[model samples]
Target: MKTLDFKPKLVSAIRNYNKQTFMADLMAGLIVGIVALPLAIAFGIASGVSPEKGIITAIVAGFAISALGGSKVQIGGPTGAFIVIVAGIINQYGIQGLTIATLMAGVFLIGFGLLRLGTIIKYIPYPIIVGFTSGIAVTIFTTQVKDLLGMQMDAVPSDFIEKWIAYFQNLTHIDPWSAGVGLVSVAIIASAPKFSKRIPGSLIAIIVMTVVVLLLKQYAGVTSIETIGDRFNISSQLPDAVVPELSWETIKGLVAPALTIAILGAIESLLSATVADGVIGDHHNSNTELIGQGVANIVSPIFGGIPATGAIARTMTNINNGGRTPIAGIVHAVVLLLIFLFLMPLAQYIPMACLAGVLVVVSYGMSGWRSFTALMHNPKSDITVLLLTFFLTIIFDLTVAIEVGIVCACLLFMKRMSETTDVKAVYDEIDLNEDADMERGNLEHLSIPKGVEVYEINGPYFFGAGNKFEDLMGGFGDRPKVRIIRMRKVPFIDSTGLHNLENMCLMSQKEGITVVLSGVNEKVEAVLRRNNFHKLLGQENICNHIDLALARANEIVG
Candidate 1:
């Protein structure tokens, strides 16, 4: 709660009114709006919706997120993370269902913020994050291949293998012009950084390719590919509001997709905020950001927009071009809105293949190839998680991939921790050496006398490692004269571990052998006192160290 406070001084320092900062913000906003143009349309089309909704989302949700969000430079809009979820909702429940689901997700996000669970969400494991992220990248790439190559399929299949099979069936009808354009677009976007740092490669590719496509359409009479106008009617007017049906039945149907959308949106938005923090050396209020996103989502859908969140690429573009405050993001939204009203007609000529080309570049950029390669050199368990998540996301679905990946990672981590826990026995053998400093007669060695045994336990004694205690103590065939348990290195113990220890003491007493404890740390001592282990084992037998326990053990044995 304390971490969520917004410092007025920090805000004033950044929000200082100046012509230089305002001009810089305006230019950055314009540039990011251009970068977002193709992506907005492509993401909408890819989600099986018309192009205008994506633009509206960028205008409405993007504006609200920046104006009211926690991060200063986060550029918000429709993101790839929401692609799988929105598509799934549209397929199962239709456009109306998708809207309702987005609204529900927004409400959930608002609740999440109010509960102040923002910081805790960071505890999600790194392997799980990478696994799902890489998986989504692969899926986005796979989904765009058909459009990029201009494959002549009536409807693209959603299943992974089936999608490829459909693509192969249409391989013979591939449009050379479209593929050439996509390849060119990829090349230009890929090489943008080498030549110019201010302008984005995707924006350049879109301009060049749109010109080329328009020329071919005018002179060649070769209409082999589709454009945004071909699929959906182009309209500059805001979509008419229609309330979606949301009875219990509709709510029940959309619950799963709604939850998935909420989770993905939360993760992507917060991660982008963190990245912006690293770039500008400032902190963000994650809970407040989430609440802002929720409000934007709730309102955007009513205006016929899709699920939206902070986009990493757009946010980075904002920072690189001198955007340093939330004002720049608001300016970006306004710029996009102005374009929608006055320039939407011109967008009709933007070919779907060109948009596809833009998405192909997006897919490539999202791949995180270096990070993927680095994970290959990680531990086997992590590698397994990476592969499992990647394959599951491609072959099955994103939701299942995340759920199973998290579970598998947790179980594997516990197994590794358990393996590091052990018990060992030690004997003082140095005194037997001839080079001992003490005289042979005077030199003394501690030994495990007959009918008495000792053991040392090390590491955390959680439920997983606690079972080993039974195995070690069970080795005694029957009650011995005395037994000592050492736990100097045991820093922590839980209820289950204490339960096992209590049972061990009871069994030893039942077998007529007194059990002694040695070398307990303050943490373990607290548990011992709370669980009454000292009372059960006897205070006299609970010695401070091994030597004391050994002496007491010898007396009992004698």
Candidate 2:
């Protein structure tokens, strides 16, 4: 493994930086910043945080990621992925708890990078990713329903079923003005790409809805619609950095939640880097990317930010706008900083329902309904994992869903591997021509000696296949003077296999039979020698070929 590599992409990107590249980066960064603005505010409000916190993250974390990241065009900021978990932490343990958890997660991310576990992200099961992602999308949509329709209610319940019940109970209190703004915003967002691809539909929806709602509220006296200012006191300046109130007790309590954040952040950032690599035909150093994310998460929370990661949407926006370097990401941060400092109070005018409409669209895109439906036709085991994760995420939580889903997937994998392992008895005569492992010009046939039995094992001898081997050995008919066990096809042996082999050897000795192991590869022979298997079965009895084993077995039979 390589020692820690602290190199960031920005270091190399600057070597060839020129006026033309800067111009291109400037255009892309400006557009992406515009696209990121509404999303930051919406995610902040939805995550039970002040709206300015989102911009702070987009500015602070966004700058850290681009300045120290591995990917050239990856745009990092607050994303929808953490909404459920962040909200849950706040609800259960308040802002301080969330802070401690975020800090712990940052340290975990750095550890992951230093340990060089970044490549492991590729091993996460696709079904599980889709399952939880779709589940999160549904959860996000549920959370936005109240704001979308302007329902008059207290806090929305955290439980999925109870939250829906609350929505039903409060349906009678829907404000038509808010509902109209939300529906129109959704319509604009859903249809805007058809007319113009360059401009973001979310930005357009926010502008149009904010203007319409403002005009209606001031002149028409339709002042019932709620806006961001009504809920969160907007801040136009960055606050002093804060040290998280962390103790050993708090760290212990927050480990699991922190692990959830680390896992989600790693997956999202690496996935975004992978996608951008495909678009730009460049390979990203995954470990470097993880470290950048670790730094971002660590710094952002100090300035009143929430958990952040690579935003695939904004990264794509950057790519489409011709951003080919980290400079674009840095410029985007600067743009958000300007907005946060000078124009944050104007954010108060943006309607809550309009933000809800934007998130509704995000939830729909995240749903991955097409992938969900396609996966239904896969193997039943995969479908089982998929559905289990999806439901668990909805009914319980994302952390539970991921854990249970991985366990189920592993069990099913072992089951399938065990099924492929073959153990069977060979009778009468063996044909060398039919044996693929033997030389083609060797002995044509070998007759079995009277009262001798031969068995072949055709796969890895792991714990999963140990019981099958035992059953086959114990179920054989007739007493045998000699037994030859073929292990040419077995690639490796586990402790369970060694234990079973020992038991078989001891049982054979008591039955007045000589046991021989045939085609024992160098590795298995070393394992047997280490276990003193040769003392139980003589060293000469372990043969390299079936012919040699048959000769020894015939000598025993005679």
Candidate 3:
């Protein structure tokens, strides 16, 4: 393993910074900042926290991730992915507990980076990712139905089934004005891009709907709409940095939640970075990105921000708008800070129903329904993992769903690997005339010495296929003077497979029969060389092709 490098992409970007790049970054940053405002507020409200926490996350975490991260254009903040987890944590463990857990999660993320586990995390199965994401999208949509319909429910239940039950029970109390505003919000967001792509649809929807709600309440006597001002206090000032109180008991109890947060944060941030890399035609250092995320998480929560990670939508917005460096991300944070200072008061008028509309749109984009439906046509095992993860996330929680999904994927992978591996006799006669044009003449007419045999092992020789190799070799009935094992198709071998191969070699040596290995691929050859298995088999017995092995076998039995 190479020594870990802690360099941030910003350092390099700044060195090559030019006037043209600065202009692009500035405009992109401003646009993305505007795009992030409503989303940050909506994610916060949906996660059962005050709207300020989300904005704080966007400003503080977003800045840290960009300034110190490995990706040039990543925007970090509270995303919809964490809504379910954060809401559950806040409900079960109060704000204080959530703070402690988040802090611990930050420590875990830092550890993940220092330990160089970034590349490993990326290997997580795609089916599981899509499954949990779709599940979260469904859950987010479910939570918003009450607000969207403007149902008069005192408090929505956290349980998936019970929340819908409450919505249905309060269906008669739906406020038409609130629902109308929400519908208008969604419509504006959906259609605003056609008029202009420079401004985000969500922002337009929030602005138009807030004004409409205010006007209707004043003149038309429609007053059932709930705005941010009615729900939580909107503060223009930044929050003070404070550490949460910690104890051994609290730390022990929070370990699980903390790990859950760390894992999800790492996965989402790296995934977002990978997407950004594709857009910019650059490769990001995964380990360095994880370290940057760790630092952001650690610092953001000190200012009363919720758990934050790379926000995919906002990052894409930045990329599409010409953000090519970390400066763009830094500028985005600054823009949000300006909004918090000057425009916070106006935000109070933004309707809860409108925020709900924004979340509904977010959930729909995240649902990945097309991918989910397309996966239905995949193999049964993949479909099983996808559906199991999806249902488990909704019925239980993300932690359970992810754990089970990985386990299922692993087992299925092992089964498929074992099925692909095979050990069988090579009974076909070679045609010498067919390969006359080749450098190595065909050994089709080459006569096999008496009491000599050939066998082929195909696919990867891992623990899953080791037993098959042993069983097939053990099934040989008659004693042979020489046995050639053809490994042309075997690309790699794990420790167990190597051990089994060693056992076969030792048994053949004891039985006074020469074991010749043929057509060993580079990877398999490296393993054999590293383990000194070639010496044990006698270097003269190893061959590059079956013809050489046959020649060696004939010489041995001559």
Candidate 4:
């Protein structure tokens, strides 16, 4: 039985807990919490929910993930990746549906961890990952255009093309005051790092822009701009936990959205953990992290929070600020909760345009343009997967893009594998000796017993190569009394390859021929042994090298 390791990183960090580390974690957590405040709000609003929901996510989900997660510095909350899917869910099924779907996704994540599928999730192709990420960036940028430009649209279209068209049509309704606030917010966020690395640029932008917009409206009588207070009510209290009522029909409808949330959450969290590992020189338990994420998602939605995952930017912030343990993540969550309890009313004064500006900067960071451009010079298959995933994400949605990208990548990979796998007949020593004599070269002679044949197989013996092996074996007009298969270059075998081998063995046995396997690697031999293939072929028939196999074949022929 496989032993399951459910140990959280927090427990390990606590074992060596010291005052100095606590101070570092406290300060780092405070700074990260400040940085998370505006982003949480922005992601929530962009996801078609109230700004407080974002804060709720950061506080509730953030705390749970930190306390139970595998990574020390990972910060979990609502992120830009969820905006498109969340908005679609809200629009189609309403908030209740979204709640149920998020809950289902949480269950899925827990299952993923319990099944120990963490390593498998990391194998998703880089091109597909980049493609969807870049696509999400584009989608996020597009979604923020209305607020950034202060366009007077009642509602932005969910469709990508239609959304752009709506933006163009509403170009005349752009408010200069709102645009000014947004641009200044962007400028401050972009340049604030030069002044002080300790303070986040987005936090600075939020503070200064909010005060500026407030002063402009109160003293100068500017009425064109919109603030969070003007749009949505800022709740100062934590939401009560409530179970979403579900029916069979509702459950059926929500499965796809739930799956999308679970998959994206898993991918983003794992990626963030991996990045944090590089920064801190620590390995994270991926399965444990997934379980933590699952628990967070399950608990968060009950408190009016959306699906949450590890935020790469916030995790980096924690690391840069000297956060070395999960305590910092816990502190960050506590700080956000405090802000929600006390500073919630003040947040209402924050300008929507400024938040939009913050999201635009976020979109820029998530764009992955550098990686995407680099991939253009890669193989045509990779490039194709990237482009296809990108366009499909924009045209349809992430679900379709991910599905198509994975399928396409798999097919292309199989094609390459098949191309590498080959089966060729090994010529007898007589033929080689004849050619050597005619060529007049100092060549060693080789001899083979009559009614003995040899064949060589190269590359992995997987499903893709099964047909090639079958075709090569089928062309043999006459059956030899003894046959040797040279597999020195073969690395591994799959069920399909094993099945084909079994068929070959049965046929050879019926024809009174002995089949000898040569140079089978340890991995392949393990599989053969597990399937009792060696017993079928007889232990004496298996050899470590071609010479031994030839000798064994000679004995069999004799």
Highest TM-score: give the candidate number.
Answer: 2
Residues 412-516 of candidate 1 have per-residue lDDT tens digits of 988897787787654433232432222345546545677777777778776666567666666766557887887777889888778777777787798898988
- Whole-model alpha-carbon lDDT for candidate 4: 0.89
Ranking by TM-score: 2, 4, 3, 1
Show the colliding residue pairs in model 4. Answer: none
Q: Output the better candidate (1/2) by TM-score.
A: 2
TM-score of each: 0.88, 0.95, 0.90, 0.91
User: What's the C-alpha lDDT at position 208 in model 3?
Assistant: 90
Residue clash pairs of candidate 2: none
For each candidate in the order shown, give its overall lDDT on alpha carbons: 0.81, 0.90, 0.88, 0.89
Predicted candidate 4 versus true structure: per-residue lDDT over 230-300, tens digit per residue: 99988988888999887999999899899989989999999999999998999999999999999999999
TM-score of 4: 0.91
Question: Measured by TM-score, how close is model 1 to the native structure?
Answer: 0.88
Best by the lDDT measure: 2
Instruction: Select the stronger candidate by TM-score from 1 and 4.
Output: 4
Q: lDDT tens digits, residues 1-558, model 2?
A: 566766799999999899999999999999999999999999998899999998898999999999998999999999998998899899888999988888888889888888888998768889999999999999999999999999989988889999999999999999999999999999999999998888899999999999998999889999899998888788797799999766899899888889999999999999999999999999988988999999998998988899999999999999999999999999999999998888889999999999999999999999999999999999999899999999998899888888898899889888888788788888888878766655546568878888888988899877656566567765557888998998888888878889988888888899998999988898988998999999989998998878888889988888
Could you give candidate 3's per-residue lDDT for residues 478-503 as a string of tens digits?
78899888888888899888888888
lDDT of model 4 at residue 353? Answer: 94
TM-score of 2: 0.95
**Steric clashes per prediction:** 0, 0, 1, 0
